[model samples]
Target: MDRTARILQDLYDSEINFTIATFWHAGFQIKLGLGDEVNGFDATGTADNLVDAVEWLRVQAIKKYPESVFATNYRR
Candidate 1:
C-alpha cells in the first residue's frame, strides 16, 4: 500500500477522539473532533482532493478491510 492509502486505512480503523488521518473535504490538513463533535478542516494543498481520495480509499478498504465501512459509519 502507498502512504496515502495507509493513512486513510488508519483513519477508518481509528478508535481515538482525534485521528490525524481524519481529513475534511479539501486538500489534506486534518479533521478535528471532540468526542462526537467534529470540526471541518481548512485544508489547502494538492493532497486534499477527498472526492478522488474517498473512492480510492473505499476500493482499497474493501479489498483489505471489508468490515471497516461499518466502523466508519458507526463513528459518524
Candidate 2:
C-alpha cells in the first residue's frame, strides 16, 4: 500500500483513534484523537504524541511528498 494508507493502517492497528483529513487530488494526513496517545511511533512517522507526529507527516507531505495533500497547523 501507499505511505498514507500504510500509516493509517498502522495507526489503527495500534488501537489509536486516528482522524484523517484528506486533501483530494493530493495526499491525505492523519491526526491522533484524544485518549489514543501511545508512547510510540505512528504510521505518520511520529514517535510521540499523535498531534506532533501528524504534523511532522504534514510537513513531510509538503516537502517530501509534493503531490500529497495534508492538514494545516501541524505544529499544534
How many clashes in each candidate?
3, 2
Q: What is the lDDT of candidate 2?
A: 0.45
Candidate 1, residues 1-76: lDDT per residue as tens digits?
Answer: 8755655556555532222343355454333222443553222123356555444444433444345543454332
Index of the highest-lDDT prediction: 2
lDDT of 2 by residue, 1-76 (tens): 8655665564455444555555555455554432434653234432344445555544544443333323222222
Q: Candidate 1 has what TM-score?
A: 0.28
| Candidate 2 Cα misplacement greater than 4 A, ranges | 21-30, 34-76
Q: Please, what is the whole-model Cα lDDT of each candidate in the order they appear?
A: 0.42, 0.45
Runs with alpha carbons beyond 4 Å of true place in candidate 1:
1-48, 67-76
lDDT of 1 at 37: 33
Model 2: worst 10 consecutive residues (lDDT sum): 67-76
